[model samples]
Target: MLKTLQTIVVAGALLFAGQCFAVDMTGKVVEVLDGDTLTFESNDGRLFRVRLKEVDAPEPGQTFGRQATQFVETLLKGKSVRVKISSVDRYDRAIAVLILPDGRVLNRELVSHGLAWHYRVHFPVDPALRALEYQAWKQNAGLWVDPSVVPPWEFRREKGARKPPPADPSAMDYNGIFDYGLIGNPDTKLFLWPDCQGYPEDSRGFAVFGSELHAQKSGFKQSPGCSRPES
Candidate 1:
């Protein structure tokens, strides 16, 4: 039994190690599905659908959506690129970061050109890449041209929920709002306060109050509040 347990532990450790390293694959871009998705043909002639890590592109028919697709097409279509596959997503599509023959990272380059937004949760935080994004924003490149552009992830969530509009704008509270910007769903007034004990998710109105200097301004206390109403 001891020996068997040791073998199992060793196998687990090896599997974990393998997952940490990048799986390198060279392929030709056969299709630019969108800003963040593409199909590439490997040396073995198999096509793999890849999702670019750490960048979210505009969806079809969305503002700057067409422009994002066009930009990606210009950069990669019919071109040989290298992919460092990170993992398979829920759809079985390979999540990867593409590398150009000239050594530019496609993920970072896309963000630099304002064709994509940094997916902060998944993408490695690179100061240089972020700076490039800022530069693109300043220059009004691609999607940055639209100053009111929303992130694709947030767009999807809002579209999925199909929630009703807030009833009272003036009555809306903004307290206890920690990590205000990190909340993905802009439509939902919910904020995830990381600092609060138990770190509960509170409504945006509640968070606004919790966040305010005068806690008395909002009826709610500093404690975690109720979840925001749907939509």
Candidate 2:
């Protein structure tokens, strides 16, 4: 009787271990919500909202936000993807590393293209991924075009208390009209603005300009959006 009970206990422990170590999940991408959010349907018909681990993209109205979303849409929308969940985030989103049918890693691709920032919240130090982000920044790829690219997390903080830029006609470029709705003041520590448009007026969105130096001069703030510009 005692031996029988011991055998049962061992079997139960093995079963629990198997569940805990399950790493692979197959799903079809149903939606590409943004640079980092995706919806997928599993084989068992379970729907999951996945947040890419070790990356953060811009919000829709933020600077370069639309471009980031479009980039993700081009990459994964309506495709079959395999997810490897590492953990769950504070917001209860499944944090995962995604691979497409072709075995292309979505997390690495985002960092390489500068579409997403390397998120280290639950991730251990990964030098390879960090190096990819640096390489993308150096090449001025994707969102790296804007020197004042602010991370989405920081953008949320500066959405308030942002004062309007000095109304100097010289400061305003006649040929280069800025979309104030998405402007960011890169000079200040907390680049705050009222809305999600351009700097001062909208501080929560990504900067849309291609030139990072131009973005800085145009009053876009830097907040962990990507690596600093080359010296």
Q: Pick the candidate with the highest lDDT.
A: 1
Root mean square deviation (Cα) for candidate 1: 10.5
Listed in order, each prediction's TM-score against the native is 0.63, 0.59
On residues 118-138, what C-alpha lDDT tens digit does candidate 1 reach at each position?
665422356666577768777
Report the lDDT of model 1 for residue 156. Answer: 75
lDDT values, one for every candidate: 0.62, 0.61
lDDT of 2 at 55: 81
Instruction: Report the C-alpha lDDT of model 2 over 8-116, residue by residue, as the tens digit.
Output: 3443344344553345689787777888887666675655567887787877758767877887788876777788876554454566789988888988888888777
Candidate 2 weakest ten by summed lDDT: 173-182
Best by TM-score: 1
Query: Which whole-number lDDT from 0 to 100 does residue 163 have in model 2?
Result: 33
Candidate 1 least-lDDT 10 residues: 172-181
